[model samples]
Target: MPLSEHEQRMLDQIEQALYAEDPKFANTVRQTNPAVHYKRWIIKASIGFVLGVSLLMAGVIFKQPAISAVGFIIMLSCTLWGLSGWRRVVGGAEGTAAPVEGKQPRAERRGMMNRFEERWRRRQEGDH
Candidate 1:
């Protein structure tokens, strides 16, 4: 559902306050393109995977089990990171799936936490 005018104004005020408090961070958040960000991570993960492979092979040649184990761990972590980034990029490609203007996922998480806190406060008050 669309936000009411009052909600919109409140959001605008919050945004302006954010900008005033930290213009650099605000601009960084504003200019970020999710696709590009995830693609960069994917690239880094690809590089990490290759490095892990090389490490694994070198460990095998040098007869070091610990090095081999570390390399395997690196490979697994890189695979996970790449897969997660790929999933996010794909999921966010849809226009309808995009969040409302000026609303970040972090804000949704914060709102959920706030609701939980409020409920806890009410429960405590009722117990008194």
Candidate 2:
């Protein structure tokens, strides 16, 4: 879905703030995260992999040794093709999130211990 106008303004403000703080890093962040683009790629590649492999295996079963080699070729193509998709998943692609002070908390705080532990976790041990 497209961002609403209010959201677009908020994003603009955030970009301004980031640019003020660090122009270079802001440019880096502006580069769309690869993760956001990966799901479509994975799906397409997966389809191609399945089709290629299936055709190859079918060729092998028909006793047509000539096209049987084509089956291996197709299998190899799918293997490599599917692997590229896997590599993209491994690359840690994700949807663009609202740029914020920190990653959103995993969950709501539930106890005093949680507070203390979380605060400790956020702090550098050497600072004390």
Candidate 3:
């Protein structure tokens, strides 16, 4: 239901008053939006991933095994972090059903592998 004009005006007035009373608090509350937070995470992770790539390249050029290893670790961790944030952002935007835990049977999970194995077995028998 839409709010009445009078109610909307009143709500706006209250918001203005609140902002006037403490703009800092209001700004903090506005910045606390989940979407914004997730976006920041994604951006930071992307930067870290780039940095890792540079480190890995530099390590290979300098023949420093330890630096290269550290760079690889940074790249892996950053990719995971960024992907997680991206999933949350996309999921929230789409408002679709989330994946249920422990709902599928083990056979169902292995269905694709089973099909591949069956095909291989048939091919092997036919070769004789």
TM-score of each: 0.64, 0.38, 0.52
CA shift of 109, model 1, Å: 22
Candidates sorted on TM-score, descending: 1, 3, 2
| lDDT per residue (tens digit) for residues 79-110 in model 1 | 99998899887764442466767555533446
Writing each residue's lDDT as its tens digit, candidate 2 over 1-128 gives 23569977998898799899999988877786765566566676677667666666777788777665675676677667666666675542332344346544324425555556556665645444
Model 1, which residues run further than 4 Å from truth?
Answer: 1-5, 92-128
| Residue-level error in angstroms, candidate 3, position 122 | 56
Best by lDDT: 1
For 100-124, candidate 3 gives per-residue lDDT tens digits of 6754433245544465666677776
- How many backbone clashes does every candidate have? 0, 2, 0
Q: How accurate locally is residue 80 in candidate 1, as Cα lDDT from 0 to 100?
A: 96
